[model samples]
Target: MSANLLPSPMSDPIEFNNSIDLSDIGGTLTLAETTHDAWLPPEPVNTFEWLCENMHSHKGAPFNPVQFPWTKGICEAWDDPRTRNIWVKMGSRLGKTEVSLGCHACAQRHDPNTGMIGASTQRLLEKTIGDRFYGMMAKTPALADLCPPKHRQNSHKVSTRTFITYGAWSGSPTTLGDIDPKYVNLLEVSKWVREQKSESDSIELALARGSEIPDRKFLGESTPTIKGACRITKFVERASNEYFHVPCPHCNHHQRLRRNTTGERKDGGLMWDGGPEEAISPEKAYQTAHYVCESCHKNIDETQRRSMIQKGVWCGTGQRVDKNGELVGKPANGIRERSFNLSRMYGWTFTFADYARAYIESLSLSGQSFANDWEGEAWVPLKVEMEWEQLAKRLCVGDWELGQVPEGCYFLTCAVDVQVDHFVCATFGWDNRQRGCLIRHGTVDTWDQVREWIQRPYEALDGGSDMRARMTLIDSRDGNRKDEIINFCRSVNDEAGPHVYPSMGGNHGSMNLRFFRKLAIDADNEIGKKAKRNIVPGIHLIMINTTVFQEWMDNVMVNRVPGDDMSMMLPQCLIEDQDLFDQLLNEKLNKEKGIWEHIDTLVPNDMRDVFRYGRCAAEVLTNGNWARIPKHRPRQLPESEADRHQRQRRTAEQLNRNRESGGKPNQSKKRFVRRPSSTSSKRFVRRKSL
Candidate 1:
C-alpha cells in the first residue's frame, strides 16, 4: 500500500499516530480500513431540514412546509448567526407551537445546550411540552432516539417545570429569574401577568438569563391582546418589524394584506360582493368574500391565495442598520432582535372565506376577541380615541404664545396637581359656546410660584378683557401635601375672587354623582371648632367620579363631529411638545375591569389628570351643563291682532307722553298695566291710585 492510502496526521493526528500498526499492513491503510471506521458520524443537517425530517403532528403525520410557507423564513432566521431574538406575532392555529417545538427538537439533537421554555400558565406549559412536545418526540424515530431511556419508558418522566436537556418553568414574572440558559422560548407573552413585585417583567427576566452567553437565542410568540399592554406588540415595535408582502395575481402589485372597512368600493382592501354596511348572514358573507387589489381594481379569490402566498416575501419596515451602518444582530453589543408580524389574511392554511366568517362571527361578540383572534391585531377599546397626530392636527395655528388666552374666551378654569418635587397646573379658557382652549400648562417647584400664577390675570389676545380663573381645583390626593393644599385653598377662596376648591378623585363605583361636593366637617374636629369660633370654615373638597368623567371626556374627544356643538382646541404651542401629547393619551380603559388606568405607572400623567380636573372645574362653573347662558332675554311674539294693536298703541302713547313732558317720562302717574304678549290681556289688569 502507498503512503497516500494512510490517514494524514492533519486529518486525525491522535488516531493516525496511536491506532496505526506498521506490522499489520505496513501502516498504509486509511482510517476507513481501521477498526474504528464504523464509529464515524454522518454530516449534520440544518435546523429547517432536520425539522422537516423529524417533526410529526399529533395525528402521526410528518411536518409539511408547503402548508405554512411563511414559517420557512422564521426557521432559517433561527439558524442564522445574524439573528438572535425572533419574535412572531401571529393569529391562533398557525402552527406556532409546532414550529417552536420543532426548533427545540433540533436544538436538542444538534447542540444539546441548556435552555428554558416558559408559558403564560402552568396548564399551558403542561399541554404544550408535557403532552404535544413529548408526543412528537415519541412519534418521530430520529427524535425518539435522542430521548433518554426514562422518557422512552414513560413520557410523564419529562416534568413541565424541569424538562429534558434544560429547565422548563411556568408562571409569570415570578419564575423567570435565577437561571441562565442559551435558548429561551416564551409562548403567549401577551397573557403573562405584567405587574410584578420586582421591577423587571417576565420578558425582561427571561432575556437577562441568556445575557452571559454569546450565542443566546430567544423566541417570543403571541396573539396580541390589549392595545398598548401587549408584550408582543411592543416587542415587534422595537424589533426589526417585518410584514409579509404578497403579489396581486392580476396586477402583480406587491402589497400587505389589510381588512378594508373604509366603505369605498374602489379603495383596495379585503372586500366582498356586498360591502360591510350591507348586512348579511355570516355564512353568506363568507361565501362572497374576496380581496381587492390595492393597485388595480381587481378581485382576488380564495383559489389564488395559495399561489400568492408561495411568492410572498417579508419586507422589513424597521431600521435594519444602526447609525454606524453596522448590520443588526451583531454579537458585540448584544443581539438585535428580529421581529415578524403576520395576520391570518396572508396565511395559506386558512381560506379568505374562513377569515371573513370569523370576522362576521366576531361582530356578534366583543371587538377585542375579533381583533386578537381573527384580525391578529391589537385591540383598542376606543376606536376614535384621541391620538397625538389627531390632536396635533387640531392645533390652533396663529401668533399666539403658550400662556396667552385666545380672543373668544370668556372665562378661565385652572387645575393644579401636586407631585413629589413640583406642582403641575393646566389652565383652560372657555368661550360663550363652551369651546375650550388650552391657555397654559407648566410645572413649578414652589407653592408660592403656583399662587403667583393663579393670582396673575391672563389677558385675551384681542385685549378686550382681562380675567382670572373663575374656578380652580387643586388635587388633594397626595396625603403628604393635603393639609398644605387645604390651607391654601381656604386662604385663597373668597366671594370676590376665584373660588379655590381642594379636589379628590374617586373610583368608578363611588356613590358620588355630582361633580363637586362639600365634605361634611366633623363636629368634634379641630377645623370644625375653629369654624364655630368664626375663624375659618372647613375646606370644601370637590368629589369627582373619575371613571364617569373619563367616559364623558372620551365621548367628547371621540364623538365630537366636525362643526359639532362641542369642541376641544389645543394651542399651537403644544403641537411640538410630544411629552404633553403622550400624557394626554396615556390612560387606557380596561373593558373587562370597567375602569380606566394608565398604561405605565412610571410615566408621569400629571398633564392628563390636571386636564381632567380643569374640565371638572368647568363643569362646576356651568352647573354641570356644557352650554353657556344667553346674554339677553328674547322678544315675545304677539298672540293675536288685538294684542298686537294694543302693544303698538301703548308704545306710541308712551312716546307722545315723553315728548309732551319735555322729553321726560311722567315721574308719578296712574296707568293701566297690561301683561306681555305671552299672557292673556285681562289676567294682569289692575287699578292703582297714586
Candidate 2:
C-alpha cells in the first residue's frame, strides 16, 4: 500500500500467490535468477504465446512450439478474429488434449472471460479438474488463482476466480444455457451419451452456448468414433479440411504425407519391404518401412520425416502445393471453420517402423481401428446387405418341413429370447454335412414349457434315433429377469449336463472379436462347495459378441459364405411365419459403428434374436472340429406316451428338489417299509429312502 516501495508482480494464478516483489531499487538484481513477468506491465500476446510463458506440461516441461510445431497454428487460431470455431481431428498422442487445455487456460488468464469445458462425461470432467485445477495447481504456479484450495467439483462444475466452469454432456438442449460462456471446449465428444432422443446433439448444444458472443472461441476435439455419427467429422466437413503437407526430402516437393502399403514402392505410398501381400508380417513391415514421395519417387526415411514435418504447412484438402513450395491449386472459398486432420504418420515419438507395425497389427485385428486411431479417419463399412422379403420368398429350398425334423439330423440346439410376459424360442437342427434347418419357432411363457421344449425328443425322419437339443441358450440381457434365467438354467443343468447356459449379448466395450466368452459373475459365492459337488457350480454367463456372429450370419445368407456344404435349409412350412420373417429382417448393420443393430428400436425383433442365438449355439457345439459331431444313429423304438410322462415327472421332481435343496445335494431319510416275506405274507422292515 506504500507508494515509496515498488509494487508486486503477478500473484499465484493457480492456488493463489500473494507474494509482493521489489524493483531494481529494492536489491541488486542478477541474471542468475529470472524475474516474474507479472511484476511488469502486461504485454499483448496471442493464446499460444501466453501458454508458453504461463503454462508448463504436467511433467514440468516448458511448452515449446518447435518441438510440437503442429500445435502452433491451432493455438493461434483461438484469438483469430475471422475464426470462431476450431476442430482438430488427429491421431492419438498428438497433443490434442494439451492444446485444448492450454487454450482454456489462456482464455481465462489472458482475456479474463467466462469459459466452460464440455467433457464427454462426469468422469472426464473429474480428470480435467482434478488433474489440473487441483492436481497440478502447485506445479503451474503462474496459474495460482486458477481454482479453489479444496475444490468440491459438484456435478462437474467448478467456481473459480476467473469464472471458468465445466459442464457434462446433455441432450435436453436447455442444459447448456445455464451460464453464458465466452469460450467453449467440446472434449472427447465421441464418447458422449444421451439418456434418450433429443432435438439437438450435445455438441450442437455446447457450441450454441457461446454463439452470440462475437469474440467467442470454440474448440472441438476427438478421435473419430463412428463413420456418420462423429462430432469431429461434422467439424471437418463444414470447414476447409486441411492435411499437413511436408516437403519431400528427395525432391523438395511439399506434398501431403501419406501411407500406402498396397502397391509397389514406385507407385508412391507408405512403402515397406513386406515382400508379398499374403506373406506380409509385422516384423517385415516395420523393419523396412519408408515413405515414397509422390514427386521424387524416392524413399523418405525416418530421419528426413522428422526434419521435414517441422517445416510442414497445413493445406486444405482441395488445395495443392508444388515441389518448389508454390501453391498450384486454390482451396474452396468462404470456409468459416478452421479444421485439421492429423495422423500418427507425423508424430515425433513413433518411427516409420513403429507406425507400419501398428497398422499391420490393427489390420489383423479388426481392419478398422488403424483408420480411427492412427489415420484419424472414420471407419467406412463395406459389406453385404440383405432384403428380408426377398430372402423369405425363396424359402422353398428342399422339402425339409419346418415342423418335422430334417432327415439325418445329427444334433439339435435351442435359443430363447425372454419377453415381457412370454418367451420366444427357436430350435435348429444340424447334420454332419453342416446343413442346418429351422425346425421349430414359437413363444411360450412358463419355465415348465421351456423345459419341455428343451427336452422334447424329435424322431429323425431318416430312420435315425430320436434327438434332443444338445445345448440351449437363453437371452438374459437388458435387465430381463437375469437372475431368474440363471436360476432356471442352473436347475436344469443340475439335472442334465452342461447343456443349458444363461447367455446375453455383450456391449461394444466388453465384447471382443471372439464369438462368445464365458464371464464369471459369481466369483466368490460357493453355494455347492460344501456338498463336494460333481462340478463346482458357479454362474458363468456366456456373453455373445452379437456383432460378429450377426455380421457373419448376414454374410452367410446374402453372400453364401462358408459355402462348403454349409446350407441354411429352408422349408415351405416356415413360409407362413410372417412375424418370424419380419423379425429376421428387423436387423441391419450400422455401418457407422461397424455393428449390427435393429432397424427399428421399438419393434419386436425376438425371433431374429432367437435365430442369431441358434446360430451361436451351433457354433458352440461345432467349435472347431466338425468331425467331433457324431453321425445320426440307427432308428430305435420311440418311447411310449406313458414312459414319456413318467420321464417328465421325474425331471420335474428333480428340478423341484434341486431348488428346495438350496444348491446342495439332497439328504437321505430312514423310513419303515413293508416287505414281502414268504408266499403273500408281508413283514415290516427298516429301509433308507431311495
Candidate 3:
C-alpha cells in the first residue's frame, strides 16, 4: 500500500473505506494518519453545532450561527440537562420558530421519543408543521436522509397533524390534551385562548400531555401581550430570567440592551441623538440613529455589533441572595425552568437604524405596538391614567400626624369597605376649600370594630381641639353582609354624632350627575324600577356613581394643578407607603365598559373604593355647598329671663338675615354648621327683631 498509494487515482478511494486498518499508527497518530483523519467530518458536540451541520433554511442553505449569535444561549439552555422548562419572551421575526423547529428535529433524531408542537389555532398549526417544519426537513440533507422509507414514500404522512416517523404531533392548545408526548413546544403562547369549559389552562393542558414521561421538556415562546394575562411573561417570572449581556466596546462594562425614551445616563437604555419629535419621520431618524454606550457614553456604530455580540453572554437575573447577601446562582434545587428574553435592539439581522425607524414609526401608530414589538415589553393598557410615582409627587409635608385632623379641616368623613375577614376604612378630613387629607386608613376585623374606630374623636394637629366624623358610609355591595350593614346603620340612633349610611355603587352613564341618589320610597313596588327597597324604614340606601368619583380621584391624583380646589393632598407618612399607592393606582378605566375596573383582578382596590366613598360622603353632607361655615361659639347659660329673651331676639334676627340671604332654612352655606341645643330651643321664646 505504501508503494502504490501515491500513484493510483483509479484505485478504490481510501477515504470512503471504513475497513482500512489504521490501528498500527494510532499512538498520537503519525503525520500521514493525522492528515488522513482530518478528511472525516467531526461529530457535533452541542445542539447549536448540530443544528448548523444538519438543519437548513427554506432556501436549502445550512443554518448560520454567525447571523444570529443571540440564539447560542437559547440552544445551550435547550440542551442543558439542568433546565427542564425553557421560556423565551422575545420580539417577532427573531427566528424563534426556527429554533423550535431545530429542537423538534433534535428530539426526533437522538431520543426518538414522542413530542408535540402547538400553535395558537388549528390553521396556524397546519401552516407551521406543513410549511416550516416540513420545509426544513426536506431541504436539509442530513435530516432528510434520516427519514424512513415510509416517510419518504408518502410525504402526506409527514405533513399531517401526526408525523409518525418523528413520533411528533402538532395541534392547537384546545386539542393538545389527547396526545402523550415527552417533549412539548408551545409557539406564540400569548395567542392561545383559554377554552370556555376546560378544567386546565391552555398551557397546563399542553404540559399535561407530557406528564407521564420522566424525561419531559417544555418550551414556550411568544411576543408578549397584556401584562397580567400574558402566559410568556408569567413563565419568565417563574423561570431563571436570563438576559443577553454584551460588553460595551469602549468601556468593557456588560449590560442588557434597552430602548430609552428618557435621556438619562445611568439607565443603560438605547439612546439616540435627536428628540422624539425628530423621530417622526422614520427615514430621517434612521439616518442619524446609533446606540450610546451605557457605561462610557460613547457612540456604538453597527460595524462593532458583531464583535460585541461575539463576546456576549447570558446573565441570569432571577437568582436571589442568601441571608449573607451572597448570590444564589441558578435555581438548581427547584423545578429548573430557564427563561431567555431578547429584543430587536440586539438582533443582527435588523440594524440599529432599522430598530430606531420601526420604534419611531410605531410611536405615532400604537403605543402597545411600540412596547410589544420594539421594546419587547408586555402590553399594559392605559399606562398614563394613573402612575404610582406621579401620585407620590402629590405628597405634602403637612403639619399633621397620621390620625390627627389638620387646622383647615372643617368636617370629617369615614368610608368603610367590608371584606370577608376585615373592614377597610379610609377616614378623610375636608376643609371648606375642598382641600382634603387622608386622616387615617387601616383594617378592622369586624363592623363593630369599625363603628367604634369611626366614632372616636380625632384631635386637631394645629390646635388641641377635638373632631369626629360627621358621616360614615359603609359599602353594602357584598350580598352576605348587606343586611348586616343595613341593620347596624338603622340601630345607630340620630343622637350619635356620625350617621352611618349603607352605600351601593351604581354604574350610570353620566359623570356630571348627582354623586348619590336617595332610594325612592317603595321603589321596589314601582313597575319599571329595579332598585331594591328591602332596607329597614329608618335606614336609607344611597346609590353612588362610583365611576364618576374614580375618575375624579384619577384627575385629582394625576392632573392636579397647584392651588386648584379639586387637587388632593396626601400626608408625607401615608404617601411613603408604596403598597398603598399601588393599591390606589391598580385600577384603570375600561373604555368599552365605561367604568373603572382593576387591571389585575388579584390586586385589591379597597383603598381606592374607600377614598371614592369618602368623597361622596363629603358631597352629600354639604349638599353641594362647600363655602366656609362660621364657627359656632360656646352657648352662654342665661342667668335671667331678660338675658334669655335678648338672646332669643338676636337668634331670630340672625335666622331672618340668613333666610333673606338666599340660604335654605335647614341648609348651611358652609360645610359644617352648628345647631342650637334642643333644650335651649324649647325654653327660649323667639321675639321679633327690633
- Point to the candidate with the largest TM-score: 2
Q: Each candidate: RMSD to true structure?
A: 20.9, 11.4, 20.8
lDDT of 2 by residue, 557-673 (tens): 554422224446567666666666667667776654445778877768887788778877776777634556667645677767788788779867765765566644333243774
Query: What TM-score goes with each of the models?
Result: 0.49, 0.63, 0.48
Off by over 4 Å in 1: 1-44, 148-163, 167-175, 275-280, 318-335, 383-588, 591-690
Q: Judged by lDDT against the true structure, how good is candidate 2?
A: 0.68
lDDT per residue as tens, model 3, 1-690: 232223265766554332344555542323466455455544334778888778897567788788778788788877777677889988877788888878877766665556777777666666776667677776888677654443443322242222342212233343565667777787888767666666666777776776767667788888876667677888887777777777777877777777766777555565556654522456677887777877688887889877887777777765543323244565532437888888887776778888877775543223455566666678655444656766776655565678787766778899999898898998888876556788889999965567567776676764544667888888988867765676566544332336777888875322223556766323232111444433224346778876457656765665544245555677766656777888888888654333567887887999988988998888778865665443431232424668546755864564455446433222212443333355564634444332
Candidate 1: deviation at residue 60, Å? 1.9
The per-candidate count of clashes, in order, stands at 0, 14, 0
* Model 1 C-alpha lDDT per residue in residues 327-427, reported as the tens digit of each score: 34432222377778888887656788877776754442234556766677887766446667776665444346777877666678999998889999988
What is the lDDT for 526 in model 3?
19
Query: What pairs collide in candidate 3?
Result: none
Candidate 1's C-alpha lDDT?
A: 0.66
